[model samples]
Target: MSEGLSAARQRDLLIATTASAVITDATLLPFFPKLFATAFGVEDPRHVGLYLAATCLTVMLALPVWARLERRWSTLQLLVVGQLGAGGLAIASHLTTELWSFWACTLTMIVFKASYLLVYPYVMRLVPKASHAGVIGLLTVIVHLGGILGATLGGWVLEHHDPRAAYLVMAAGDFLQMGVSVYLLRRGARAPSPEPAHEGVPEVVEASADDPAPALPPIPQRLSPLVRLGLLMAVVYFSAFITRPFFVEYWGTRSSLDGELVSGWVFAIPALASLVALGVQHMGWSRPGSLYKWLALIALGVAIQATPLPAAIVVGRFIYGWAAFRGLVDLDLALFEISPPERYAEDYSHMNLCQQGGVLIAFWIAGLAVNAGGLVQPLWIALGGFVVGAGVFAAYGSRFVAAAPSEGKAPEEVAPC
Candidate 1:
């Protein structure tokens, strides 16, 4: 195949990868705490806690591997192999009855699932830079929506059928994605890397014989403000996922709590809230209002969990859904604005690493909190984290935005996450 991505081909990459994003996250959500009993003999929250911790480490370590491999091979190629491998692992984990077998297979699959990290760059390169935020937002929506669908499916399957059935569905979904990736490979033209607007221009300066040529300023190799913003985003994402794994068990234990399936719906409220946030954003809601609004929503969610009331917990989650979506999406857009199109993959890989690090820390805190006080402490931790993140952004965001060379930077595009 020759280079240059077609519009239809970009669409395929987006659909396949977005679905891939959904299945992996969705496949894992409902199996925790509830399903741990059947496979591990101990249904304690600690097991799920430990498992998520392991996922944190596995993906953290594995993401860099994918990033490195992408430098040498095709991202689409890695995605193809990763999907098939992850699919087989999902299916195999379903087959294994042993706890050790399950954990090993599941965690290993996450290592492969790290390939999902590359999809950002995969689609980023496939589309023009101008559309980056829109694509990212749509992908973000699909991802959250996937979480809803996955959790609902997992919960429903567990309620009616065997827990393993959920994995089977995930496996089927993975294979379908793999097929899509393969078709993109076989039929689509090889997408060309972007060339800078001034790439071929000669650096000519008119000078008189008596006038010596002035030395040119060096191109900036490092963007410290952008790096700082990236860190803030990492924290935001970390704060977002900190309490995610425990929602089912957290809400399920309440006296007024409905059932496993209902827990999925409860978990899904944030995604719905996210859609609302996106609509508000699309409608030209004020940009300056982002930081305070984001912090408030996050604080509300955490405070709700802290209340000891189950109904409060539900209310908080909805508030948090909106908070997480807007905060994460805006921060990502900030990064997009600062990034160069040529370094898109490399830059996002670094961003991914930072976000993964935050998630890893979240898991560590989550595991400890679960061990100490059931599941409430992590919310406290996440709340504190959100506070720190919001402060960091508010204090430094304007400076960072000011730091950009207006003419040098890419155009800022707004999209949902």
Candidate 2:
């Protein structure tokens, strides 16, 4: 077997992954509403909400299919094709003279976005098992860094230039990511072999001929622990996003703050929270049972967000963002611990689908709540969901916490890479 990845190769992989992630996040969040508004002649937040629902549906549907395809093709191959498809579709949206074309482009983006899902499993395979949590945490931080940069850069570009220009810049980043992925694959293929495998033996041979070959486990069955962790993560993601649709609606009815300033605060809060997530990574409070601690912090952040003053809301939003990021990091590490190598993509896909499914439900509920009641009502609902999710974890999550391998117990032998 090859000894291990060199530091340079690891760095290159991280850079490439970061570039791809940033571009994907940039395209979706800050720029998408603007793009849809311009291209479709629609400005209602409800329309944007519908588009998000469609995108989420597409991603959820495509993931299982993508996971199956990943079993047949290499990660590098899938990633390159995905990048090119996404970039091309994004550029094509700008060429659309009709609203239908924009819809078509969005649909195509769902297919392209499947590529972004593969990166997590690939990174997990590359890192040492002992360092799984730290590496996963680092990767999550990189992803947030991309999100932070993409949001800031997209905002700046949109202000200084046209919406189409933003897509073009994003497309350029996608193409660059494709190039780096190709290089990585080529370099990997060309590297000299260290040794030869035994002629018939699998890397992780089964113990008995009478034993049936282990079936490729279904996503739900293979990842029960991760599913538990995902339940908690879903709540966090849902809480953060449920109130999003009503931000503009809420501000529109208010008289105290300038409309633009209020909008800025809404966006700025998450961005500030992202920065806090980065800072918290170094603090060493990320072990098991950390979810409950972060949940308490998130509740405090929500309480602060409920305050009447704008300054308190801004600070609270930052805290929410911080807690959200920490929750994600811990949950991701937990997932890595529970997932088996053979089912990595399938397991990760399921976890993501679970999170997105919760997001879809929250968005739909929030939309209805906004139409029925008001903005503040949805925030209160999210707070309740967070509390309930934390309670569930506190009650049932202790069984899965990472622990030292016991005396006289052999380490679980993973299947061959």
Candidate 3:
């Protein structure tokens, strides 16, 4: 089976890379309130939301810099640096005595952590285009699954230890990622490298008398389809996150749940649904048409969770679980449909910048709504915003596909040690 698994090593590395994407977020999810207490001397989760927004602000600021760095360095080299740097900063973050100090460390840490995003484009060079969807699907599954287990275990650590312990857990993941990257580099396996397609913005070609360059569309023309889809997906995620940081707080307010650990289960339910969707998707049940229905259902579920009724929140969350999974897969498929194989990292980074923007917006609103208004206000925002986003998604449905198909296939040969 190992011999038959062509590119199995690459596949393993991709999984490892994807694992880095979710572990910290999931591990840290259930401990936000505690972190707030440690940093700001408060028990309010609203502070957690604000801090999240701040971290994302740094992530947004760093995106272009990382994009440029990717052009200069190999993916493995960047991964090693990102992992070690983030791991060090993460550990340092735990030692902060005040909110400002913690924020400084965390923001720096995120800048390094963001390097994980480059791995997807690098791995695309190793597999067939027909396999891209499957690879992405499995990658998504790993993401949610990592979050699920991380949340569960995180809740446990919070029960027995301090919020700072969660940071330690995150640091461990960074170290592990660093170790994997080092192994890959030591093995001397290199991802297929692509030439620079374009720089910071879309470039206009200059035609010379000796060689007439073909006139091509500007960046906006090239990125519109994916950008529209990205905005829609961002809305959904942004809306959802508005309420996510406070799930444990909300559960305590609305239900008889004892602590954040118990409420973490509520958070994990949707991830559970994602796993189910992945299984069904794995069994050849995926369909592009499902995107529309999933969006509508997600909007509905968000509305339900936002209502005053506790039972509705539970039921709504279950539906949300299923819908979120399908929507995430659909959005990725949509991205894949339009993505240039040669420019996967560049293109996806742009899309991710959009997603991060959504997260930033949601977290800002979450901080505002929860801090100044009411606990349920973010849910209302989510309810309204998700519908608006999904509506746009459906409206754009008739036309969405890559301008051209990706010409990627199995590596003709890879650089080996």
> Which residue runs does candidate 3 get wrong by more than 4 Å?
1-6, 43-46, 193-223, 284-290, 308-311, 400-417
TM-score per candidate: 0.85, 0.79, 0.85
Candidate number of the best lDDT:
3
Better of 2 and 3 by TM-score: 3
Instruction: Give the C-alpha lDDT of model 3.
Output: 0.72
Worst 10 residues of 3 by lDDT: 408-417
- lDDT values, one for every candidate: 0.71, 0.64, 0.72
Candidate 3 has a TM-score of 0.85
Candidate 3, residues 309-375: lDDT per residue as tens digits?
Answer: 7788888887887788777876776666566566666677777777788888888778778877777
lDDT of 2 by residue, 310-411 (tens): 677767777877887777777777766566555567777877887787787777776566566655777788888788767665654454333323222333
